[model samples]
Target: MIRGCGRLLTMRTAHRVETVRAAEAALMTRLPEGALMQRAAAGLAAACFSLLGKGRVYGARVVLLVGSGDNGGDALYAGARLARRGAGVTAVLLGDRAHEGGLAALRAAGGRVEADDPFAPLATADLVLDGITGIGGRGGLRPDAVPVARAARGSDAVVVAVDLPSGVDADTGEVTGEALRADVTVTFGTYKPGLLVDPARSYAGALRLVDIGLGDELPGVPDLEALQHQDVARLLPVPGAESDKYRRGVVGVVAGSARYPGAAVLAVEGALRGGAGAVRYVGGAADAVIAAHPETLVHPGPPDRAGRVQAWVVGPGLGDEPGVAEVLASDVPVLVDADGLRGLDPALVRARSAPTVLTPHAGEAAALLDATREEVEAGRLAAVRELAGRYGATVLLKGSTTLVCGAGAAGAVRVNPTGTGWLATAGSGDVLSGLAGSLLAAGLRPVDAASCAAYLHGLAARRASEGRGPVTAGEVAGTLGEAWRDVRAGE
Candidate 1:
């Protein structure tokens, strides 16, 4: 994990498989047959050298898990370079067919291939280069090589994966079965979507992009992207001296029920901390909301007469019929979540001209898509895209890796890089709904509002969990101010 959200991380843009392949082909045509591979090998070798730590490359034990295809060739070539530098390198082929040229290169450089007990070198290796399967691999590790893959992962040796981790889906980030975990992955040309998303992202400890001059050939519009601190800071709503309560932004809260007023309170907490100038409450839990936040402007009845609010955050504990339809009729941006998602008509949601943002967990998303939760979780990318198109709304699929996508296929999806499992506490999504709604009220587009909110929400959760203790929804909401400061501080 990269830790804090406000720190400067290189803006990571990931492209689709077809896009990457086209770029690779374009670049390959201009370069010599082995030119790109050699460049990738050199970069991979240099990365492994730094990770070797105390031992000199002159005598360090380097083990390569060579599989079929160019992935194996890349590792074999890198291993050959390491061997030439006096490192004791060994290649363990997982399949019958290995890269012939690469095998010859390794042998010529005094590197040897292991015929048996390949796992032995992994246990005591200074570095392990995983070439098991590359970006094109599907499913998981082959049954025969699973044990060796496990051995390399469990070893004290520094693990560096070539291109991508063997079993991760390059386009979707889904991990189907047994996969190799890499401490650092040296990818050529560009970042695949899987490297930036969870499930597959968790397997890749740290990501290192090794450019092989495919930038010019790649598509201008990337498939996925992650916002850095500067980008978020630029999007945040900053109030000037002349700003007033209404001028800054007013976010209406239409949430909570008789049984779950606490959801209203949590949502209110996040709204208060959000950039919005004032929060207007228009739900059944006005008394409970006012008790927790006396400063809130409370209004009874439905959101139809909630004065003037720039944006409305509906759902949370509002149940199936919390006057959500009436609220959506307004010309302001609305964010729908929780029980509000139940029995929602896609046509009704799309009929509103205003921007609509949907914050749905895997289960809620599955329900909306009329699919199983397992199906949604397994192919989150597809589920989120389908939901976004179906409802004509910016969908934020909340989970381990929060994914934000605009209403249609052309809009580039954003994968949130912040957050922890500790953030899975109750009422957290309610807080997120409020925060994102506040951003929407503050004049940000639905995509910006949702992505920025997820960033801040995750940052707050991380700050709250500093002591490694369990965090509550309030704790996460409480840290939003500090998170906001951190974002602007970088400016």
Candidate 2:
């Protein structure tokens, strides 16, 4: 399921263009020629009819921004369905050629085909269907279609994209050039990467997947997976009757400097609620951590001086710290973040006997990859995968769409669907690192720990921000229990 927020949701599996095409080809061979298109058209029309509200289809002004391929055909056929229901449907053919049969169907349904200025029909249009380019069309929209695309955006009508939005890479979620932004995207068969990963994900406002009977033909593994509440709930650790604090798990946190004592406190705060039995704080901010969390065991200097810990979360606000190497040397899962991520040696991380997870924002990731922050943000999926491969760790690239890519597992990347804008506040990454580290200590795999931590962290941010305007890092930490309970609700 494409799980998001605090509940179970639809299948969030996304496929690449080639995978989708192969599945479609197989499905088409078993069905009638135009049957697939008809199924898609029916779903699209039903979605639009719902979007326009009850009794609004009759006399509603609908405009189709049609191009050449099946994407345009889907729009045309859906437009025909609207026309048959008494809507004033108009198809503005942007390409030189149109889908002949789709055009005929629209004409038969009394829909007008506009070959002249497309702007006139858009003025009073109640709905604009973007069908300019499909999954195969790349490098953005052609120069000829720019003005018309702008007009559609400027219109008061609800802009709906057919399949993938025009100008976005279906496989990579990259918007290389000018593209159309839609209010809602009605995708056929399955979800595409562009619809889930940002910056292309932002272009696809709200996603609606239409099952066109291709589920059976798609492969067992998908390109991406977004965890639902149930998935996260299943991964969370539950204590046994005989379990003790150490027996449960101990999370080691090496964070905060004298200048950033609050970071240690915040990290410990998150760790306490992250299903771990105990937290061990080893850094410069021991006093602050003790003051904030009296239950935490504190150490003043090096990490080896501290008691045993199942996992270590090193680096949030640790300005010029020396414990990263010491922490990495231990035979335990290590989560490196913020200051620890600075000047991290890939060979050192790669040689670790235990699993490692790296959580970096766009800027840190860009620095690590020797690329610009803009480039990392533009192509997050690629950046995260590359970081995982290079570091030999499960990399969690945090941004608008937080992604987790496991080392040596190139097939499926986990996309955190619970992320919110409010989680971008200061010390948030610190909280996330500690939480993930706690999960790791609780025996979750590096990938599962990272994914579940991100999921709960985002969900906690949402819970903290609800009816509260903006939320602080501490507030997000305070709400972790509530978010955990929300995920485990009804279980």
Candidate 3:
């Protein structure tokens, strides 16, 4: 198994490439270029055949979208391998100078150069190999390639992108123009950034990285990371026999109001389910909080009087209450969310002595950064990191793919893979804040707590829904126990 498959699986494509390059450099001294390409071709052919089930390769029409770079070569060579097995493979050249050796190899193996009209062959092929671009390609699909990409999208055949979806930026996960949406992306050597980050990620579905035997050369650290089940399990706070409520940690929650008391209930539910030793609730909705989870210690007073909490979860349904200022002012690891983020002073957040974590959806994040919602959405990584640096806190920007970044931790942004679009429903974020706050109280660092909670929260949401339909905030909290078990079991 890969040394850290569980952990490394979450790393950005650039880091994976570094590993690939290092491995290649060490092994290149012994292996020829043709040998490496053969290995890659073998792997790609095997994967494609597996996807094809029991279907015979002979007489199966395959279309290859060839480009100028080696990505096109991978496709062409793979086309040769398939042709040898009796498949009718056709290469559609997209660039002027195609990979000469690969094109010759394909022709020698009986693969033909079909009509260059990109759209025609796509309508009938059993499978389509998108070799228009690779990790080296920048920007979106070339103008001539867009209509062809659309035609492929409309087809029923499985679309396999070589390396990554063409036109998607490899390093930044940005899509400049039209990109091919592949059913499976057969990436060579290692993963690219576009495969993990959104907009670009959406295009590269079911990614599989083919090893060209480049393993020994990667760098020590990656640019971005994704946490796996085992990683989260190892990082989770498990109390010992001697651990007491005080020792385990206390989380003070300042949330809700008379108007939206349900937010308080959900937040408290999240905190209790989050494995905190004790959850102290301080806000106007103490009655409602108590009614929901009597286990929570409710205090009907200012946040300052909440009495000794290791961490604080503020702003869930706070409704512009004056006491929220007091909660924000406290010298504790704080998680600011929801209404607590509205019209807040950045200077006050910066003045805090303790670590702070801001959890914001797109709109809330936009408001805090003084940028339009579209700007934040366009540059999620830049927006979150900017907020973390400006406030000297941890920022957990919540969306389809949540991002966790520390103010000063260089190259330490963590992208969450566990969440689903179904989590976009109301009151889900409050549960997240509570769960994150509970972990913070239980002694995990701000980024760790936030990211771990997000991973679990998303997993729980997934479990609760079971792919059927919408789930309630309460269902998410209720499913945390099973999620925790699955994480512990290393599932």
Per-candidate Cα lDDT values, in order, are: 0.89, 0.90, 0.83
> Best-fitting candidate, measured by lDDT?
2
Count of clashes, each model? 0, 4, 5
Over 4 Å off, model 3: 1-31
Q: Which is better, 2 or 3, measured by lDDT?
A: 2
| Cα error, candidate 2, residue 384 (Å) | 0.5
Best-fitting candidate, scored by TM-score: 2
TM-score of each: 0.95, 0.97, 0.93
Instruction: State the lDDT of candidate 2 residue by residue for 76-168, as single tens digits.
Output: 999999999999999999987999999999999999998777899999999999999989988999998888999999999999999988989
Kindly report the root-mean-square deviation of model 1 from the true structure over all alpha carbons: 3.4
Record all residue pairs in model 1 with backbone atoms less than 3 Å apart, i.e. clashing: none
The RMSD of every model to the true structure, in order and in angstroms, is 3.4, 2.9, 3.4
lDDT of 1 by residue, 1-491 (tens): 01122432456789888898888888899989999889899999888878775458899999999999898999999999999989999999997799999999999999999997898888789899999898888898889889999999899988898999988899998999999999999998888999988778888889898988988997766889898778788778888778888987999998998988999999988888888989999888889999999999999866878799999999999864466888889999999999888878999888998989999999999999999998888788888899999999899999988999997644679989888889999999999999999888888889889999999999889888998779999999989999888877872
Cα displacement (angstroms), candidate 3, residue 357, comes to 1.0
Question: What's the true lDDT of residue 425 in model 1?
Answer: 94
What would the TM-score be for candidate 2 when compared with the true structure? 0.97
